[model samples]
Target: MIEVKHLHKTFRIPAPHLSRWERIKAAVTGDGAEKTAVRDISFTVGPGEFVGYIGPNGAGKSTTIKMLTGILHPTSGEVRIDGMSPHKDRRRVVSRLGVVFGQRSQLWWDLPVRDSFDILCAMYRIDRQRQQRTLAELDGLLGLGEFADTPVRKLSLGQRMRADLAAALLHEPDILFLDEPTIGLDVIAKRNIRGLLSKVNRELGKTVLLTTHDMDDIEQLCDRVMVINHGSLAYDGTIGELRERIGLPTILRVSFEAAVSLDNATEPELGFTVAEANGCELTVHFNRQELPALEVLRRLERYGTAQDVHMEEPDFEEIIHKVY
Candidate 1:
């Protein structure tokens, strides 16, 4: 479990100098520009909850994660993990948390995958039996055996990601913080990582905080999501609640057997907004609360033989767009 309260983080950069004399003038003036990365954001993650922390670039997502993981201290406010302050007891807190940054690798580049794991186990003071068990479980879940003997530098991006995930979990931490874990991965690799995250959260009972640009990752893995923009919390709720709040209509594209003129036919009492219409096909936007999808389908059956019907759900990007 994690709790953050009124968190604010700001960085101060030296003001630009106009000339050699101006540099001295600025230094004497003590003038600097302060950039606020995270501004008074607050949230909580209950045990075993899988949360998606999402935002556009420079949205303070990574900054928040770093603060939670004790990599960077917060400027103000408090961050507590399982009732313990990460900054106060960083070493102890780290033992109970797993973190993976997609842009950085914690593994030794020249070392084989197994060697890195071995070193990590030694660093964590893990017993051989426990390390073996963890490695075996990760190997089974992530299919890491294929590249266990290969050096980290030689492994493909997907393979390295899997290995990094395994390394992060070797100690079986209670919470996992994944910062763009599936970045640069192909479709299959992304799916594999998503499945693994779901398993870890649901089956393994690990609390997961994931930040990604991929909406599929949020849809597939997160039970709850928090959207941030301009260094603030814009939206925080269940995925369903978020979709409903946006009034973002679900798109239903349907193709009828024959063209039906709207002027002559009596309008069916369907609780859906007609987004667009052309010839035999009509794009309908409906509120999930007002009309269940099954009922909509049944009503559409009355029009004509439905050739094709495709439904599109509002994605995370769309939701953020509405929030910002």
Candidate 2:
């Protein structure tokens, strides 16, 4: 299990234009330029659980990840990875972690995929037999064999990401930390990656903490989600619970074969609001808790036969916006 207690991180902001006397005066006056990237936040992850860490840009999500991975030290409080102190036992903590940063690469830029895996073998000290075995398993899961000999620089974004994931798993870490693993991929590629992650979490029984801006990732893969905003833990719970708690309207837009009957009349049957209506099309905003999708569709049928229908869930960003 991973545990964090009241963790905090602060950084000094450099001011090159400040005169030395001005800097001294500011420091003496207790106005030193500093910013807190992370405030006192605490959360825990049990074994074999998939959790999504999401927030807007510059909301201390990456900073928290770095601290949890032992890349950055917390200014205060405690971080324990599998009962080991990451600050004191970084090596031991690292051995249990498999981290993948979407914008960063751990693979050798000039080396082929196989060569990079070979290098990871030495770095993680994997025996030849185990290396081959892991490679074979990863190949089956991630389809890495086709690009095993491709140099990192020559591979496409999807290929490189698969290779990176393979490299992270070669050592058989118990916990995987993925940050925006599907940031720049097509639909098929994203689906493949999500499949791999689901298999890893369910079949392999591995613990995963994924940080991403994609709501579908949270919906499909994570049973629980933690939302961070302004360097503090704004919300932490299941995504379903979040939607229920926030009580945002799930949008249902319908295009009818004939003109819609409710052009100006307020909807009184289901206590829902017709946010927009234009002749044959009507956009509805209703609480999912009050009226489910099927019931909403049933109510819409009264107006006319729907030629086309589209349902939109309250996205993660909008939920966060509403909460904050």
lDDT of 2 by residue, 133-224 (tens): 98998898889989999899999889988999988898999999999999998898898889999998998888999999887888899999
* Residue pairs with backbone atoms closer than 3 Å in model 1 (clashes): none
lDDT tens digits by residue: candidate 1, 135-237:
8888888899899999999999889998999999999999999999999999998988888889888888999999998888998899999998989999899
Least accurate 10 contiguous residues by lDDT in model 2:
262-271
Please give the CA lDDT of all the candidate structures. Answer: 0.89, 0.89
Q: By lDDT, who's the top model here?
A: 2
Native-structure RMSD, model 2: 3.3
**lDDT of model 1 at residue 256?**
92
Off by over 4 Å in 2: 18-31, 253-258, 267-270, 291-312
Q: Give the 10-residue window scoring lowest on summed lDDT in candidate 1.
A: 260-269
